[model samples]
Target: MAGSTDVAKVYERFISLVREVHWLNRISDLLSWDQQVMMPPKGVSARSEQYAVLSGLAHDRLAGNEMADLLAHLEAHSDELDEDQRVNVREVRRSHDRARKVPRELIQEIVTTEGLSQKHWLEAKQKDDFSIFAPWLEKMVALKRRVADAIGYEKTPYDPLLDEFEPHTTSEEVAGVLEGLKPALVELVRRIESSSIRPRREILERSFPIAKQEEFGAWIVRLMGFDFEAGRIDRSPHPFCSGANGDVRITTRYKEDYIPASLFGLMHETGHGLYDQGLDPKHEGTPRGFTVSLGVHESQSRLWENLVGRSMHFWRFAFPFLQAF
Candidate 1:
């Protein structure tokens, strides 16, 4: 028997709670970025603890009774809310329902283990020793399987894991799509290998100084419309885009002998950065401002890297800059 005013108040309270959770996530993202980009090698253990504490706090805040009560009240009054409010309520409910199923300690442990695993992964990659990372990988797989079980799935255990990124999709659906595309993709690759026409691959194999590559890549990324005031690029072992709103950051790794590694990687990440910067700031801290899924998120990066960055028309304007570099 709640009136419109009560529902509005509950909606605002719900948003306030979710906003704090969102801020916690952003802080966690910053910590993770530091862990990957700037943390000293020995700092992994401490960073893992920090991640665990933060994960537990955020999970508790999201899954607490107040949040549950607010969601129930808001959901009951769904017809009274506007489209955007309803969307936010619905998205939060989905996340809350799933999160409530998993223990906060489990989430904390998973994040803590993840930080250690990342450190081990870097070591394994550098030393070319799988043994360094294999145990951690096994632990992570087991942890994630436990999470999938808690979330509940109809078919494969991977379905819940896939739903984490894709939402409303199943492994079977993804497998069927991939199965359909594999033949065509294989045929395309076969045709490319058999065709006699080939470009000079050695042109990209020239000695491109790392400093010059970074300079050139940043210039191109700026030209691609990533606002410098809002975003910047740096170096990481693997290229990625992180942060959002007024402070997006991207990273790329350079190889002195291979130009495309950093160049195209920066372009790919810049595409993601641009998308991050483009989200509506008014809806910040809410699902309405976020990208829908990983697939759609990746599409932006691939589109820029493959469709636009690789096009001859783009090369027509960009080749001069490259030659100058």
Candidate 2:
């Protein structure tokens, strides 16, 4: 990927910026999610202010003039980029464009709104009621619509939201892909419902202690080589991992009646923690230091869950812990 030491240096700076962005954005989103699902009611106003500051900082960082210079430098030598390098440049440009459009004030507003919406969403979900949170949801939708407008799109208004996760792919394209898979999914569900072989699920329904589950979750992340020195874990309704710099945070839920639920979910988030941990520290503030895109980020999570967590080797080490619980 390097054209010379000069190009490599440029990439180092790029990676550093990306690392900072990933850490900041991930941490911001995770905390907001936690405030909704776990945090105490008293913490809301304080958390909203904290989120606004973080939102402003990240927006200013990504949209700075230096990113423009670096991007132009890379663009000037487009012919020299290797295949992966080419993809990196293309992805960075796409991100830079979106970052450039939104004002920091608007970002701060969105961040504050996120905290407020999440706080209310928890209350609504707890009550099994939507109307209680409908106003917040509606505001969020309007904010997101403003975001989509700022980001600019050729087709639908939702394209910007979909673009956040996948590069160069649109809402319509995703719709088409999902449409094609629907029939196959329907048939698969039908066949599973009609199947004669019924494996006993009682093994998992036996008593599972919460403390033991927590210990097992901690033990599994360690086995996966996720650094406790730089990152940590906690409990949440739905598990996720995120952080700023080395201080990554991970969360998971416990199900006392089920054995596999929390264990695998913990490992699934740990997988994401490892990627953030593995990113080059030298590129700590640049976009390239972060993951190339969110699809690739999901791949990292899926790889750990499906490719590693499900593997014989991974299970060889992990199944014992679950069995103990």
Candidate 3:
């Protein structure tokens, strides 16, 4: 036998789970990219169906007893696992509970609306027109409010949406932070605008070919301790990173004149990559195997962007690398 019916077999089952779930996730990647760039202008209806199917697969996988059993097994050994595996098991269960609480129809509706909202938002933003987006956004907001109600919240509808981006954060808390931030940011901008000094205007705007930029981005990711054998990157209007734990995928938009567009984005996504890479593999496919929360995930992205990308240390180590071209 490859192993006994102990933790090793459970671990083997986890491997099967990882492969199965990641296939569903990859289907989503194809749908997302096609929706943004390749699908026919008239394909929205078919595309929605396609997305719904894939989302259903992912949702079912997470909510079904299969995932639950895996989680249960892992959790039973909770005390034996190290901190990371414990965290992974915890996350697996959290996702299981959160997703199961909502019905499948609701998940399909929300995903469809968000997809449409994104499409409308892009068209509206492109035309410098809010009117076109207003109706769709209002509908989206209403639907979202319904979602929040269905999900049940402590105080406000916005918490659920915020939870999508920043788990455990409430609407009031975000508003409070914004209320404080708006004034501080405004003052900072006012002072900076009044100052005689200015940041270099065209440093990022200088012409750089997309092919070359892509190459440069790949190089930088490698330097950041990114294990390319474990992951890859792609192109999208809005860059995002996704994939199964070890097989992380990142995406970015390429702009010929703006260096920041792809270069920095890949690094930001790399932070996400590192976090996934750091996850406890022994807990893979279980609650304790994934990110703690969206907030924790965002913190990883922000840390990579600001803490690492903007640091003197980063610049010192990588600027000459950039200055090469």
lDDT of each: 0.91, 0.78, 0.76
Candidate 3 local Cα displacement, residue 86, angstroms: 7.4
Off by over 4 Å in 3: 1-30, 33-44, 57-101, 116-119, 125-132, 176-187
The positional error of residue 301 in candidate 2, measured at the CA in angstroms, is 1.6
Per-model root-mean-square deviation over C-alphas:
1.3, 4.4, 4.6
Q: Name the weakest run of 10 consecutive residues (lDDT summed) in model 3.
A: 1-10
lDDT of 3 by residue, 185-274 (tens): 999999999999988868779998889899888988888888888888888677887754667778888999998888889889988888
Query: How far out, in Å, is residue 50 in model 1?
Result: 1.1
Per-model tally of clashing residue pairs = 0, 11, 11
lDDT per residue for candidate 2 within 1-325, as digits (tens), equals: 3466677677658656755666677767777756845688899988999999887877776788887888787778767666656666777677778989987888888889877777577678779899989999889889888999998789888998887878678988889999999999999999999999787979768778989989877887898899999988887767877764587788888888985788778878888888889887755544545665677777878888888877879778767767876
lDDT (C-alpha) at residue 165 in model 2: 72
Give candidate 1's total backbone clashes. Answer: 0
TM-score of each: 0.97, 0.79, 0.75
For model 2, the run of ten residues with the poorest summed lDDT: 282-291
For candidate 2, the TM-score is: 0.79
